[model samples]
Target: QQPVQSPQAVILREGEDAVINCSSSKALYSVHWYRQKHGEAPVFLMILLKGGEQKGHDKISASFNEKKQQSSLYLTASQLSYSGTYFCGTDAYSGAGSYQLTFGKGTKLSVIP
Candidate 1:
C-alpha cells in the first residue's frame, strides 16, 4: 500500500531545517527516499532497512522505525538545491522471494532565499 506523507508541502529558507514523515499501515521491509526536481526523474537519496541502522548524507538524513511502521526524513540547514518533491517508497515482503514497493504521494519542498 502507498504510504502517507505528512505536511504534503513545506517552505523553508536556506540554512533552515525541515522534517517530513511517512507512515504505512502495512508492514515495511525498507523505506526508500528520493528527490525529484521539476522535469527530472527521481534520484535516490537513501534507504533505511527494517532492522538496519539509520542513514545520512550531507544535510539529509532518515530514520526508520519498524515497530511503528513509520519513517522520517530530516533536512538540516536546508539548501536551495534541496528544493524538490520528496518521495518515500515503502517496500513490503510478500514471501516467496517477492517484494512490492509503493510510493507515497510525495512532499513538495521549496527553499527560499
Candidate 2:
C-alpha cells in the first residue's frame, strides 16, 4: 500500500524549520525520501531500513520506526535551496523480486525570503 503523508503543504521563511511525516499501512522493509524541484525529477535524500535506525545530514534528518510503520523527515535550517516537494516512498520486501515501493502525493514546501 502507498504511504500517507501529512501536511500536504508547508510554507517557511529562510532559515526556518519544518517536519514532514509518512505512514504506511503495511509492514515496511525500507523507506525512501526524495525532493523534487519544479519541472525536475525527484532527488534521492536518504533511506531508512527496517532496523529502526535513523540517517541524515546536518540540514536534513529522518527517522523510521519499524513497529509503527511510520517515518518522519526533519528539515532544519531551511534555505531557499530547500524549497521543493518532499515525498516519502515506502517499500515492502516479501521475497525474491517480490517487492514494491510506493510514494505519497508529496508535501510542497515553499521557502520565501
The local distance difference test score of each candidate is: 0.95, 0.94
TM-score of 2: 0.95
* Local error of candidate 1 at residue 84 (angstroms): 0.3
The runs of at least 3 residues in candidate 2 whose Cα sits more than 4 Å from the true structure, single-residue gaps closed, are 94-96
Residues 1-113, candidate 2, lDDT per residue (tens digit)?
Answer: 77999999999999999999999989998999999999999999999999998999979999999999999999998999999999999999767879788999999999999
Residue 76, candidate 2: Cα error in Å is 0.6
RMSD over all Cα atoms, model 1: 1.0
TM-score of each predicted structure versus truth: 0.96, 0.95
lDDT per residue for candidate 1 within 28-84, as digits (tens), equals 999999999999999999999998458998889999999999999999999999999
The lowest-lDDT stretch of 10 consecutive residues in candidate 2 is 93-102
